[model samples]
Target: MMRRSLTATPGPARLRISLAAQQNGCASGATEVTSARAAIATAQAGLTAAAAADTAARTRYLAATQAVAGARKTMLRVQRQRPYRSARVAHAKSAVAIVTKTMITRRAQSGKATAALTAARTGLSIATTRLAGATSRWKTTCAAVKVTQQKLTGTAPTAELTARAAAISRDVVTQVRATFTTADATTVYGITVHRSVAFAFQRMIDDAKADGIVLSGGGFRTRQRQIELRKINGCPDISTAPASSCRVPTAIPGRSLHEIGLAVDITSGGKTLTAKSAGFAWLKAHADEYGFANLPSEPWHWSITGS
Candidate 1:
């Protein structure tokens, strides 16, 4: 909590991250539901067309059946007259056979259309289910948005917390200053800093104070101070040690931003800012406006170049 030095690590990042993720999920869910509804519409249209085709086919089939029946009666009457071989009887028989075939064809067409209609109805049902699933998922993802939003906006930190942060910053300033003579460095608000960065940092701190957050840190380490940190933090060869080799992750002497007075290890409530600190949340949201950049691996570390 360089901002929440007393609170917890990883809180602020998660709050903002959760806030963004939930909002995106809500949008995706809405889109899915919209697509499902479109599918339902298409299915309904297909069903309607199929039903109309089935009706037309049934009508034609019925007409064909009636014609076939009349033909049969005429053929029977001609047969009773005792001339089965007559051209009239032959013609009547042929007419009946033709109508029977037409009737059967229409029946098949009607059956096929009915089957299509059934499939369309099934498709519509599936689409509706999809929409329901999408809606449910969206609601689930958005559930956490309210709480995380409040976290990012920040609640007023307790007075005790504020005092602790200021105290820690003061102690750190004294210790860091002990590493080198302060006579040659430019000091602003008690933290040694590069001249180019002093103005922006002051404005940023003032703005933070206006918004109820106290910002403090140590800066401007001499090259010798860098070597001391590496040794104290446990790097085998302090001067040549890699940043990660030290127990506290010290940068090699010449490479450190502190030596040039461009970086500060920030503090709030006397603790390093954790993701959950109200102080941290404020900085996370607004530090960039004043041209400060943070090192991802070190929440307390921020510099003009963000190493």
Candidate 2:
């Protein structure tokens, strides 16, 4: 009798299906890793570019500083020489006048006086030329000094441009770091929050979800991230603008509760949470029991202390 096969062989269709599933699983994992690495590389590139720009700006600033110093020195030296140049011109004019008077008074020695007068006039002409040249040099030096000073510290275009560039470079550095941190964070209630607050935040989300309300988005921002948001919202610096006029009230970097990992920005189904929203109302009624309180001015913002 022929021996029978002990195991059943999978049909072609089943084999194909199993292979496809395995491939899909591997592809998904690989794709996720690849995308994360790409994001990291992009963030790194942005940081590098920002750093280079900052270096260039600093170099320009240093060069401008040196230029201003040199220009000021030259200007001072020229300024100090001004009185001397004026005196030389005045003396030349006086000498010419004295020679003419002598020629008018001395008629017997007229030839001698005429020769002396001609020599004095020639000397006067040379002195006047030297004075004019000195005056021109002084004026040019003064203008150069002014231009350099403006470049160094004034609200001149060059100064403004460099200042703005420096600020942008700093902001870029912050943004890149923020991006990386946010990417690495875990999600809580569809919102990216720091690991420390995930449990509490999730509880809040679950409680709200049970009440037929969905909480979404917001939590634990880095200082740099806060700065970027502040800029986008056009929020005035708390140090400068009055509190009443600020449309988006954002705290400065070190002062924000988000930086400490205790705050979250709550929303309802991808919409901003406001006083009128059911989610906001639920938060107001029950969030305090979970150690969360809404910021009065910002309905979407909640913190441990509600400040």
lDDT of each prediction vs. the true structure? 0.72, 0.56
**True-vs-predicted CA distance for residue 61, candidate 2, Å:** 91
Worst 10 residues of 1 by lDDT: 1-10
lDDT of 1 by residue, 1-307 (tens): 2233233336766665666576567557767878888888988888888888888888888888898888899889988885356888888889889988988898898888888878888988888888788878866764554455446446435575456544654454445445544444687788888665575577567657767888888888878888888889999887676888788889987777788676888887678887788777887887754446678888888865567
Predicted structure 2, TM vs. truth: 0.38
Clashes of each: 16, 0
- TM-score on alpha carbons, each prediction: 0.47, 0.38
Looking at candidate 1, what is the lDDT of residue 84? 51
